[model samples]
Target chain A: MTPSLEAVGLTKRFNSFTALDHLNLKVEGSKCVGFLGPNGAGKTTTLKMFTDLIFPSEGESFINGISVQQDRKRALAVCGDLIETPEIYPSLTPREALEMSGALRGMRPEEIRSRSAAVLEEVKMTEWTDQKVGRFSKGMKQRVNIAAALLSDPEVVILDEPSTGLDPRGMAEVRSIVRGLKKGHRLIFMSSHILSEVVDVCDDVALLDRGKLLFADTLANVSQRLGGNTRSVEAEFAAPVEDSVLANEIGSLPEVASWSRADARRVTLQVKGGPAEQARLLRQLASLSMGLISFRESRSALEEVYLREISVGDA
Target chain B: MSADVAPARAGSLPIADGAIGTVPGTIAQAITLSRYQLRDYLRSRRFVLMIAIVVAVGTILTTLVAYYRPVGLIDNANNLYGSLWGGGAAFLILFAGIIFGGDAIAGEFQNKTGYFLMGLPLRRVTVYAGKYLAVLVASVVSILLFLAIVVGNAVFYLGVGAVGDLGQLFESFALALLYLLALMGFVFLFSSMFKTSLYAVLVVAVLFLFGFSIIQSVVLALTGTEPWFLLSYVNQIIAYPLTGVPEHVARATIGRATITNYAPTYFEGIAVMLGYFFLTTIGGLLLFEREEFT
Candidate 1:
């Protein structure tokens, strides 16, 4: 069965200040959707609504096709969430914390026992399983927090900036741990203002700003939507290559709208069609043996998209 | 934990929400949560510290009564019990409740742990009830342990027979438990109403310790009436049972006019205390439910 999350004209107001305004979006399971926006964009607010931490001024949130506002318990049964930078009780060990979470989620004692071990290992926190969380670092606490969130093996996992306050190593470790949660085709809804964080973990992105959904689609589709019927890709190579010779070799491909040498080892090309033709061109370019290091879309596409959408909303 | 967000690694199938067995009922959830709460308190240093204080106080009281036999205080074990537990019982009940329940809901919000809890499948009322139940059980245990110290002293001084009537002690013990529940509910109400634990603790301390008594005295002096609604006024019924059966509405002549002084009977005390239990417990839950994690 398909699990889904939807926000229907959802609005939230903190008295005179409106946090979210008639936000409408729906997402299905089996995809890692990034809830992306800048600070004060209400990404966190929207996530809170989905979990019913705060009631909305208007509208409703549905999870797994059940109304969260009307029946939060049933709606949230399939969800596991880590919102903001919530800390566990300092006195509680990782084992106890996960056990409590698992027990509340209705897992059997045997299941809690087994999954407690499993999730701790998943987050690489087995060593600190019995250690009081008080002495643990922020990163350590965060890992334990995530472990608790996954205790139920929820179909939909929600995290707000899973690596927000961690050091670089901690962030990398968190990202790596998040990568390991791909078993059983669970839907991971992660929110972050950090573009790199979203880009690193999300398969699709829902962009919100000032509590409004500006865009929602796969990266490729977003490029198509905002790149304005065009795709600009940058191909990077390992060593310096003759620009003219490189351009001349694949310059005549029908999908190549235009090609320019970014530098001795890089070429910026405006391409057309979609992933199919792009793959075909990649094969042709790789065959040239011009030290073709890596080929991917240019950042300008999303940079342009962010600026366009946010600026329009600002207007 | 989030699944890999990179496009290449995301899952390609949707797992159903009810794939797992159904979430347990709310009551079951509350009990499961309470076990953790109890364990937390049991393991905490405060529990040990509180116990040590009670033992020390009991030892001093026991020694003073047995050897010194101060003035007219200890005519018998019954008198000794009444003197030891009288006003001191109110403080015990109030202190025990505050120590456990004062930070209950506020700590969750202050520390942002409520975000983690509210995100779960259990309802808000389940969490509130769980915390309250945990505090109630723990407070009852703490208060009883203190009473045991006093009882040991009574047995040592006046022998097992002098420890007062077992039935009365039991009745007193029952009243103490009721007081525990009522006071805990009051603490929980403050806990839920406030956003910070420090404020919750302070408000509870000030109100229960001195604020209520002062207000009750003032109300009685001015209105020529007993403050029947004030918990501290009616809470005396616990120790009053140790001395005599209370007249529900005691009357006395003061100054020029005959003023009435009201003291709750067993049932009146139960009614007032249980009213506190239900009213504040429900009030706290409502506040807890409406609160935003942000």
Candidate 2:
């Protein structure tokens, strides 16, 4: 059976303010889908509903094809979630906390002990397993939270902004752990406002704004379709080229939509079309005696698409 | 991804295999939750504070009894037990309920721990029942410690043979336990009512400590009617088995008007306590069930 998560017409309202409006999304199989949105884009609200931490005002959430609102226990039996930085009891060690989690899930003592060690190791919290959570840092607690979510080896894991409050190194470590999770047969639904983080770890990206979904698709497809038929590339030269000569040569190429010089040796261009067009432009550049050293597509293509979509959504 | 597809049956889907086992029933889940929650309570600072309060109260009473050596209290076991256990047990129960249960549910929201527990395959009712059970057990332990101190004093002052009527003492103890349950039910209701632990703890503490007593007094003074509905009025029954039931109503005329004092009968007290236990416990569970972890 395939792991799946679905939100059918899911809507949530706090008084007059709608946190999530008519959300309908479904993810299947073993993949990591990033739920991307701005500060108040209802990302955490949606994940809370899916985890049964908050009830939906309209529609329903389902886990593995079981209705979350109707049969929460059975629906979440094979699911694990870390919603909004849930704190463990200060008095309890990670081992004790995970033991409680495992017991609640009906895991036997032997199973709990072995799995506790395995998940603690997976989160790189093996040394702190017996230490009280009160003494751990935010990143350590977050790792313990993640380890608890993985204690049951759940097929579907829901994480709400796992790296929201972490430092740079902490964020990198969390992303690495999330990347490692993809190796298993699991459907990971993670929410984040960090665009670059989503680009780094997510296979599919679902963009939401002001309680509405703007688009949902694979990262490649989103970039290709919404990239406005153009891609940005950067070219580095071994030596400085005359401005007039560089402009005249770039203007002669039909594939070059726009160009800008970062310095005497580096030039950025918005090249028209796909890899073939980029290849033709690079060939044309190499043909000129401009001492070209290296050329690569800039990594901000997704950022451009995201900004455009979000602006369009706001408009 | 398709949103229109029908939901798959849970049985048809791949259940978590290997180390993961089937989820337990509600009772087992509640018990498991109770075990962990009890562990937390045991290690908490409030538990130590409660024990200290009990010991301090016991120490004060012990010193006064030993120094004064009151003929009435030292000569008879019933008077000693009634004055010591009956008089102090209610306050101990109130403190115990407030210390252990005042934030049992509200702390989950304020501290954001529910975000972790509620995501699992456990029901709201299970969480409520489990926390209530933990509070009950912890409160009982404190109450029993106070009782031991009372019995210790009785043995010291009146000798082993004069340790009061064991039957009446046990009956009073049973009544005290009943009162503890009712008070905890009320504490839990307040805990479920608010999202902030401070508010829940304060409201419960004030109401149990003096709020209800004041209201009971006001009602009796103004209406000249029985305050039988009040838990404070009914709590007198915890000691009445040892001290003998008092007159249901006593009226005295000062200069202009007559003031009335009302006492709850054994039947009325038991009925009121049972009503509070059922109504407040069920009401708290319902509130917890509907509350969102927002």
Candidate 3:
């Protein structure tokens, strides 16, 4: 589990404004880690620093344990970075652009030819390989942009809000691509502002606020630790039940603070106690004439922890 | 670098097929990037426009020289050197620099192309050197093509024997290229300084075409001093080969004031162009290196 990407005391300042403070983070192994933050939280700045697009005011970053500032050529050689909204030359065809990019990475002739096809297909842009990128839509351009990053088959793929400005369909397509990349032995680090997007695609979340790492751990850990005893649970029924019966059953549970029948077969309840009381309620509901099919947390617990941490940082 | 990134297994990457070359040195990367960038420039619309402009001007100059055959212009060498390099070549060099180098650096930042390029393992100095070489090749090719057409016509009208002193044409050509490098260096400097492509192109075009001459004129008019420091003074050497250069010239009685026009010698002209080349080229690269893609 050697670290794929590491930042040590990294900082960036612009005149009086501090874009990123002294920050340290190390992501190891092959997995998708979500770099989450509010707008102006220095996600893009961190990505830029990793790629050596700008020098850090203090400290440094490393790729595969090679200091980026010391040996940038070797450090980033195995990385594919898509920072902000990077555009390929409008005049170049996708194939031509990929070939150029491959050559720049020192790939041989046959390697460029072969990888040009492979990356174009990976981004689902094989059909439009010969067409000029100038005519491409924003989503198509973004796909090609990501495709360029994949040309080198980098061990660490750094995407800075890849879904930004893409339509819903484009977002879904990019998400699918990210999901597909997980099977490979590559560490994908993507930054996004959307909470649900991170929850859906990332195995780990590193939340930042005001240029500080608020928390960095598994989504499950964050949700479990922050999900308090008083939690909302959604219950689904096998068949429709009358409103009177649902109310009588709701009144029978002492732990239930509030209850509502969302539909003929579903009920949402705010249980006051922890998991034990919630489990007792489920058992009690199963014993009743009301047939229960499933029970689950009503909302993403990660959202709660995120809000709490962000508020604390703000204070 | 962390155990060679998992031993570079063949086709382990979805994008790459079997194997790839080891990461190259800075010079190697720069050369590779330059080759592609040069190809892109050659295929660009600006390159086509530059060719057309050079062709049109060369045709007009040749046609006029063949039909009118200026009275004092004794031979093909005299006519070719005087009108072609003196007029057509000077403007071509300026236009070539403007057409290619104006948006060279600014376009990367303005278009956000640098976001991806700078993300690569390559250094900023590599990117800068690659682009500089690309523009240089494009400009030199265009200028030489224009001169070729003029030379071809020289053979047609005045015969090959009449154009004996062709060596002077080459010397003039060399001088023109030196001026082009200097002008393009300035263009690149402006390109790196500004964020907008239009501003870079406009500023360069204005200064080269009319701004330099106007400034030089104003300085001389106000101070009664020769503007030897101006690069435009040295640019005159591009055409000076065709016409005999006097040691110095003085115009009398500009409303009871006499003014001197100092002519730069061949060595002096080269020194001036080299100064611009070094000063602006270094400045441009420094600006490009320090610039942030934010």
Clashing pairs in 3: none
What residue runs in model 2 are displaced by over 4 Å at the alpha carbon? Answer: A235-246, A261-267, A275-297, B3-19, B162-165, B253-257
The DockQ of predicted model 3 stands at 0.35
DockQ class, candidate 1 = acceptable
Tens digits of per-residue lDDT for model 1 on B1-294?
A: 111121221222332544355688999999988888888887887678667666676667677676887755554655566767664667777777877888889989897778767888889999998888888888778778877776776776667876545566677788888888888888988999999998999999999879998999899888867687888887888876568876766677778877676776767778999999999988988888888887
Residue-level lDDT tens digits of model 1 in A206-243: 88898777778886666666553557789998988675
Q: Candidate 3, after superposition: displacement of residue B265 in Å?
A: 1.1
lDDT of each: 0.79, 0.87, 0.81
TM-score of 1: 0.85
Best by TM-score: 2
Which CAPRI category fits model 3?
acceptable
Per-residue lDDT of model 2, residues B33-83, tens digit only: 888888888888999999999999999988888999999998888899999
lDDT per residue as tens, model 3, A231-255:
7789898999778776776655887
Better of 2 and 3 by TM-score: 2
TM-score of chain B of each: 0.86, 0.93, 0.88
lDDT of 1 at A215: 77
Which of the two, 1 or 2, has more lDDT?
2
Q: Sorted on lDDT, highest at the top, how do the candidates line up?
A: 2, 3, 1
